[model samples]
Target: MKDFITPDTGTQIGTLALQNPIMPASGTFSEDLADVFDLDVLGAHVLKTIMHGMRAGNPTPRVCDMPSGMMNAIGIPSKGIDDFRDRMLPYWAGYGAPLVVSISAHSMDEFVRLCEAVSLPGVAAIEANISCPNIEADGRAFAMRPDTTHTVIERLRGCTDLPLWAKLSPNTGEPAEVGRAAQDAGADALVVANTMLGMSIDVASRTPRLGNVMGGMSGPAIKPVALRMTYQCARACHIPVIGCGGISTLEDVLEFLIAGARAVQIGTATFQSPTIMARLVTQLRDWMAAQGVSSLGEIIGTLEIPQAADGVWA
Candidate 1:
């Protein structure tokens, strides 16, 4: 029998240390997953985005299937902070894994308040879902521009001493700039992106498939775009970058790691197989041992590019 080599999968995102680099993206993760696998096996448990007040969310027909991915305008329905603090927090505290609370708000003040509320003990970090519409910016996402991204992060920073992970949006033209803004404003890490804006029409009905007409698209189709953004942000910012998008397979996770992401989030894929995240953690360790790699740091940010005769990257 071959000797079993236990590879180290541990990784660090600012002050928080994860047992592994695999975790579920916000909205895709929930307490229900505990029935399928041990929640403590994951690097961290990133809860679904919670709001300041109870929300009904968007109208019906909020989700639509695409050829390669899915679209949703679920509008971040939440039971509000009170329920989260009173019930959800205590339940999650029982788990051994670190808890990362994801929060969203419509205004700058609301964002700060939400951050402060979730900054209680037992919470490992706060992932600010800044991709949502900001009323202060006329319904534009706070992450759509560097200025607003900085402003919101700066204010949130002042309200909490907990590590803040700013989740960026893919809709912006200046992804690197937005990432840098978040880092400069005190974000400990950056979640490379949120879902891309897309719409699908039902040809037979001649109407939008989603009730909201447009929704955030996620899944394998957006992997390339998300990977690119992850690479760019990883290079532009000094803070660690957490890649999120269509990461369903081990290869997808490897690509993001080489692209400079210190950690990666699994989203839509979890719907297909609830045990995927847990399985990937095992697979990663096995693959590392086979490749003679001992730690995650060896694979993180090790992409190599060849230069042409003209001194340009080929």
Candidate 2:
């Protein structure tokens, strides 16, 4: 048996590099997982998205069931950046999965302030929570519009020296255009996708299932949408892409990578099995060995899409 999961499968996203590219999206796997799985084994860890202030978030009945997945109107509830630094940061440092702090801000100042605060020495990097940009005012996810994404990143980009991974949203006009805007606005890397905006209805009750009328749909349901965005954005932007949405098994991870994702995020799968990440990581290592591949990079974005040259994979 050889050391299949070596540093070569390891790759860099800005200044942060990991043994592999399997990371948990913010909010999917909270810090509470230490009770179940050893956080130290993960390739990278992305903290839950926190904001400038503690948020109560939507109403009751925040989650609901959909066809192949679930929907959540989890409006970014957290203990605020200060509280996170005081209570969570210490614990985050202990786990040490290349700490990537995620923060959401409504106004530009709020995002910059949050970024500066989290730029503390212990944090390896930061992932801008630009996913649901509509939290403040708009009718869509905030990052859904290119201008909003660009402005948010531009304001927060210089707040700290740490690398910024702007998580892109599938709720945009053209996924590729927003990907380009993120790169142009100085994103160190792009996390291709948050959940798709959707609502589930209970026909008998004649109302939405979630507390809020709309919820962010995740899990197997959104996998194909995420794949399309990842493939498209990878070609359009020069920055690296960390794919998310419905990644459940070793095969799913491979699909995203072969389609040109530098790394992939496991979302809804974690909810089903908290320890699934550990198994997936182990499986990926075994798969790599069987394929005679010594490194993960060799397989990243290797798909032979003709449109890759144009920054839009078919």
Candidate 3:
């Protein structure tokens, strides 16, 4: 007897299409785990967020466990674009999936420079990390205003010819507005969020947890928040939305799809199980088959949200 787990469903991020919608979050899925599982089996691969300059990152005690998911203040430690191109790109090319290299910088000039540098030979696409703190210049906040998100993509648009995806932050007051900013700024896609900001403390020591005072929270705990934001943002803009934060199971992946996510990225979950991506990919296909769904695209965003008694879809 034959099995029914074949991925008949397919999707694309910009011009680079994918066999499935599941992918790992940047930085969380490292190149060091090649032995544990086959990265080629994945639909796509996004390299960790790299910067124009090398990053030492914040202090130790970087990660901690929370009730639903894990929290981290990793501080975006990258080897820099030049070094990443020299080393990481080679490994990225080895993987069969589309290679998306995430880049971050403080100034518009540095962002443009980094985009130009990394759009080298092997990069399939470039994802700009605008939420990072400006360690050298001023302070750092999630690219709160739409203007900053717009300006960064606009500046980099002229520099590199590669497809651009602006990674948005859920810590914002309005995710949809920022999504539109990315669209207007000429971004090919938008990552609905990086991580929501949350902090924890140890009552015993009377100090905050994690190396940094605050950090981005990701895991099963944030799934509902990510789902709602992704849905709203997708409806607000024409660009595709790559759902991140708290995506753990096939059910979670389905919820994101129904909520309007074109694709989903798996994070914190990977730290506990490197093979989760492959497993989830398999499960998605199997679930699709059981539902008599020929193509995943056929069911995406197809949820017919019933109108309220007052006749409002809300």
Per-candidate alpha-carbon RMSD to the true structure: 1.9, 2.9, 2.6
Error in Å for residue 127 of model 1: 0.4
lDDT value for model 1: 0.94
lDDT of 1 by residue, 1-314 (tens): 55667899999999998999999999999888989999899999999999999998998799989878899999988999999999999999999889999999999999888899999999999999999999988999999999999999999999999999999999999999999999999999999889999998989999998888899999999999999999999989889999999999999999999999999999999998999999999999889999878899999989897664464546
In terms of lDDT, the best-performing candidate is 1
**How close is every model to the real structure, measured as TM-score?**
0.97, 0.92, 0.93
Q: Model 2: clashing residue pairs? A: 133-142, 134-141, 134-142, 235-311, 236-311, 260-301
Best-fitting candidate, scored by TM-score? 1
Q: What is candidate 3's local distance difference test score?
A: 0.83
Backbone clash count for every predicted candidate, in the order shown: 0, 6, 1
Among all windows of 10 consecutive residues in model 3, the one with the lowest summed lDDT is: 133-142
Ranking by TM-score: 1, 3, 2
Off by over 4 Å in 3: 1-7, 134-142, 309-314
Relative to the true structure, candidate 2 reaches a TM of 0.92
